[model samples]
Target: PDRIEILLGVGSMTVPRSSVEKVEMASPEQNRAIRNQWKTRYLLHEDYVPAGMENIARLLTAARDARDTARQAGSAHAADMKHESSLLARLERLRSELIRVSKRMQNASRTSSPAAYNAMVLEYNNLYAAYTVGIHELAEFRAKHPAPSDRFSFYLDSLDALRRAYESALVLPDSGQDADRARFLDRVARIIEDYSRDFSTTAVRSEHSESGIIVAVTVNDSTTGRFLLDTGAAVMTLTEQFARRLNLDTSSLPAIDIVLADGAQASARAVILPSVQVGSARCEHVEAAVIAQQPAPDIDGLLGMSFLRNFAFRIDPSSGQVTLTQFAPR
Candidate 1:
């Protein structure tokens, strides 16, 4: 037979030899080493970034490695290490403030009156201009000092920080009311367009029906189903049939009391799913409940606050489109 046989713990299986792609054999020690390397390899997006940005990222990585090496070598670099720590602390504070400002701008856009929105826009524009000037100054300093020095790491860190700040600024809601502001944003978008794949905003289409707004949800990246967009639900819920399809062991899970939409009380199993995704937005370790029956015949479950809380989302009445943005806290 032109097939390969595999021995399982309690059974045997066979697969067509032609279906096999490739295989590798390694000792346990070698396998563990390879896995460790993979685990430590962060920021994989740098590989695909533009060459100039990639070079900057590599320089930052090298600076980090040098800092680590200096730390391991003991007391000789103590003063320089203290200065590095100070610069990093300042950078972190700047990043936190920028995130807070971005969140404020988003909130104002969504909920504020026209006058208030315009006021916030003016404030944000001023802050943006100030940060831009600071970034230019940092670049000028870096250009003047081409050779590596004690302050070189700070320069690279500041540039990276400003780049992230620009990304955050881009996510701010723009009503296009101000021509100057719109032009500034467009220029910033062009500068960072290549690096903004994981942009903070994502849009997912919804279906409007008698059962309410419905959106497609993916569980554990394995199963997908239409779920009613239920902001009132404290946790996501799955019908017993859907849970079974996901191979969730409801019998072994703990039971919890739930209040139904019809004002009836029922007991259901509680479970935490590995992940739940709506469009490009994904959240991990989401709490979900498994009920005995579906809420609606067409819907498999409810897309509850458990998943929605992780984002700032709005459903447009005219288009039935849901816009989700990463929620940054003030």
Candidate 2:
């Protein structure tokens, strides 16, 4: 057979043999092993299109088409412009609903009964499908209308909202629900890829050493040095030598308490850096701490949340690269 048909609770889906990555016996042990091996590729019955999804898809498409027509009509057509505004508002409502339903679905997957979980899954699939349609429409709209416009920012806001929703969905418990986890990861990866392609992002090459992963960081647009990538650290931290090298007035800066990786508490001066740049991804008015001693002989400081929190960042060990995309709040 050139294709395979997967039976689902609601229906079934057929896929070409070329699209099928692997095949395993439908046994619990085999399923677990396959899930472990391919965490992000496994699919489940719940991943299929649920009943009533076709209608939802049609509704979303119609709404998007109507909005596109209204937008194309321009301001001369007052009624069509009003219709477009209405459709935009409806799409925004749909996005909000999708977020709310996904949160509930997350809870259901964790603690609900089988029947209750199934019900939530159906509702979630419908909303998620509609939300995806809305995202495509927004992407198309943005393509037609470039940046520096209010509408462009609005579309970006919608995309950011979807990204956050996907992130929240990724917070599932370790309950052997590999399919759901994989689905969320696949969506998050797509969103991250889309962000990299559509928006300004920075990828900085990192050095992995015994101490930790290190990347070059520029402080106040002047002092450039290597810093340990420490997500656990509360704020950007610099050794006294590096701080003085930057000509920072540490003497007048306020002091704060910080805990070292060794679980020792120490006092450090707090400094507000005018800017911190990791590759091209920059954050201004970053808070940092100036410690008396350097963390490592070659490392100047710790790149902490103060800098990283400004962006959605991913550290890839295999590639030894840190990808940073500006986090836009909805």
Candidate 3:
């Protein structure tokens, strides 16, 4: 035989069996290793796709098609943008020519020669009409490729194509209904997670802050302060000292009773700060708990889920860098 067709899940691939020195059924360990390798490549963990061969194949196929479509769309968009730029350049040149002709026509009319003046007027009218048409064409081109809509279409097309592929895969043999639904939901979740990083921002930890992973933050649109990144904390906490320095109106703000990390219950003022900023990531009108007692020494506040929820963030302890990816609008 020239080749051996091996059935892998629901899909089959032909390979030169002769090139293989040995052929043995893969052990459970070997199968797990192979799937693990694939899972990493597809960014889909074992729990994401369910425990079945056909479901695996379907997920892989959907991912592949979506990736391919994204690549093709990107290339096409690049070429289209280049073409549009060229068209704009030509329009600019035409406008420049029209301006030059208008100036010449004005000089001709002042020369006191009727024939020359008449000829210049005729030429100017023709040039103006042509320029008008060029402007209209340019406007049409821009309207055809509006920036926001073009970006939205690319994402929409990729998602729609992947969805359709997934739906088609559901009908394939060995794809159980429960398994298919799980895989589809997981795929959608991953896509949503990735999309959340679209407007991602990054910030470096402050070197001046000594105790913990402290980063620079803006409070109430005015005060710039250092805040600690405490994942354990449920909400944003501002130190009383810092709040007083900023002249925060604590009296009128709502009060929240919270248990301190040291197992002590404390009364804290709940105030909506005008804005809180971490690097390029900023969340406006943020609700923060102002504690009269200092949570830690020197730090102005604690960066908790109240502001962190707007973006998915990761802190590199070794490099002292905090990367923030905004998943939602303010």
Candidate 4:
């Protein structure tokens, strides 16, 4: 992942947006890949977010702001000592003291022991965040212009009860395995109520065989072209012969270092493909790697989740009607 990040940063990148120009209706197989990709992205936005997450975010932001203000204020301590008068000199000393204090605050913002402090205070801040959110509901219940709705009052009571439950859940008799499991379950419930399930699992599929990545050949690479379906791979990868068919400058692709599961490393040049058609699916402007001179198998290329997540997916060995959308990504 680190090596890929470097390549993405330094490699001569093609304008990925315009890589693929050819477009056509997806065959039955391609549609499945495209459909799954769409579902993955949709699930990301709708299902991955947490409950009361906004309040926690606000608390974290406030802590960060306080920390930043302390650091900036501390920077002036050196200049404070340079003052001509004794009183000014004293003020500078105070500035230096404030800098140290601000640093402590910055640490608290990080909540990483030295990076932060006052765990009890941090807990209170989190509590206040929840309280503030609940107050909105409380205020809505007692508005004078509105007729008192018993239902709204009940909602306020329910919100307060939830807050009490949250507070109680924070207390545990001991940090045993059972307690740990309960905490985990509580967090999951909170996530389900606040955020969606998609965040817990993204649309990444990894298949590790004794050989390596699970590459399924839908079409064997021919003198003309071929396609491979790969859900386990993280990125779309293609061979040099197929890339040459698109007329792109493969030389611009940087030689990347990739570590396989078995600690084996490989060097390969990366390129953005115009498009790839696998089974009934097609991906436009997909990023792929053109491996160095090697006898590769499993079709001409493998279409990974980056292309697969652009559409919904379903697999049935009986019918083999894989489908995908080759248009704008999900």
Candidate 5:
């Protein structure tokens, strides 16, 4: 059995092991008990034990008053301490800013120079042109050895070709060249090769049934459930209700100058479709039509170039399935 001592009450009482009792404190003891209400209320404790907030505020106000009185009394010491506190705060901020800038300078020194960004952009543009040429070359290669079923593997092969070309162009030594030298060029080329290999293509659609370069797509209108798969449209558009279901605002979008397939132009706008699935691919920020009533047949939605731009797409008539191969990055 452990010895039990009263916490709130000063006097001690003992009882049977299994029993518990309610005890009341005497008035004098109660008054003494209130001073020890909190553990930190002990004077030697390290934590801040504020005497009522209002009282602390008054003390702070008195400190300010004392400072002011010290100034009036021509005491330089008190004035100097207040000045020093403000000066130290400013110096601390300045020191922090200097440290931050020094870190940035160190990082910038380690990474790229100012000319490096421009050099990268230039290299990227050159690689883009090279990729376009590679696309044509790859098409010729695929015609010589055509296996459209294994498009991913085909893309990887094309990527390997591009990498071989890029690696052949490398004059950079492993440990000898600067970090942003021709090694940077190798990285950009490899990135392009990698990007071209994995991108997906969109399926094209036409009205009622499928036609050349056109696939079948379904669209449901709120007023009329009927949908027309329109190939004549350069961009796919959704009805106002469909747009709402896609959680898009019909208004407040940037107006797009859309040139139609008929060479006639229409003023349209960009709308983002978050959840539209294109052949099992989940796409975000899918740009759809905000404007309606085109020169050609009005479609609930038509597959657009923005989708096609991601892929090297060819509609195979022999197989009814529109084969969307991976992107060629042309």
Candidate 6:
């Protein structure tokens, strides 16, 4: 039997190659090709985002570069900054107009007014072009300017919000999805909040792969071992061997039923951890389960939402940093 080794987030496992159906290798060229395809589909589609909007986008970029250069060289005036601000204001107005036109389009469809619907489509197309220009401008700006270490925590938070806003704008074909559009707008409102907070903290490096992130997690505030960060999992889980190695009292806990990823059923014991810490984020009274076996031998446990949901986190696969920040509730 040929043994095949696979790397988990924190550990490695060897399995029979005969048991596996197929395997694919990841390469830089493959990644670049995928990125190019997505860019053409979403960002460079002429039918979706008009040619005129691209001109506005170029102008906005020029204005931003000029303002930034002036500020960096200590020659920037109020008017230099105001130039970009004015363009932003105009973009916001266009977004609002697009929303209004979309609503009319939705209504016109219900009334079967072909002429009215066509007119609304024309208006939406025009407004969408302008909105696309603004979205791309801000996105490029953020990507070019990495937040300094002092502001990195909140910068990561705001970046996520901005990305969501841009994605929502791109997918919103017309105003029919008003609720979705409104949600994006609300997230955009929080971008400023993300910028206002300056929480300073150290980031933890993690071993990651295409499967997920694997990091050393501290259990009960003392013992540390390799654990997989699985946000989709409802609760934490530990293999029986790993739990025993840590000297945990698995027998004292109540038994609970768990469904495995392969649709198999298993039993485990529910245990409470006084403290569980991953990177800089920590939680107390965390619920966990101890199982007889895991798919891999080296992985001690699975870190679930109980520990992750408490903090705002960003996983940078390229950098291998899992940045976590305590967020203020909305």
> Highest lDDT, which number?
2
Each model's lDDT comes to 0.62, 0.65, 0.63, 0.42, 0.43, 0.60
Best by TM-score: 2
- Model 4, residue 177: displacement in angstroms? 54
Native-vs-model 1 lDDT? 0.62
Candidates sorted on lDDT, descending: 2, 3, 1, 6, 5, 4
lDDT of 3 at 47: 39
For model 4, residues 247-323, the per-residue Cα lDDT tens digits are 54444223566443235676765443445445445544344556543324534555565466544454434444443
Clashing pairs for model 3 are: none
TM-scores vs. true structure, each candidate = 0.42, 0.44, 0.42, 0.30, 0.32, 0.41
Relative to the true structure, candidate 3 reaches a TM of: 0.42
| Cα RMSDs, all models | 29.5, 26.5, 20.6, 34.5, 32.6, 32.2
In model 5, what lDDT does residue 161 have? 54
All candidates in order of TM-score, best leading? 2, 1, 3, 6, 5, 4
In model 1, where is the ten-residue run with the lowest total lDDT?
42-51
User: What ranges in model 5 sit over 4 Å off?
Assistant: 1-236, 239-241, 244-247, 294-298, 327-330
* TM-score, structure 2 vs. true: 0.44
Clashing pairs in 6: none
Error of 6 at 255 (Å): 0.8
Relative to the unseen true structure, what is the C-alpha lDDT of residue 43 in candidate 2, on a scale of 0 to 100? 37
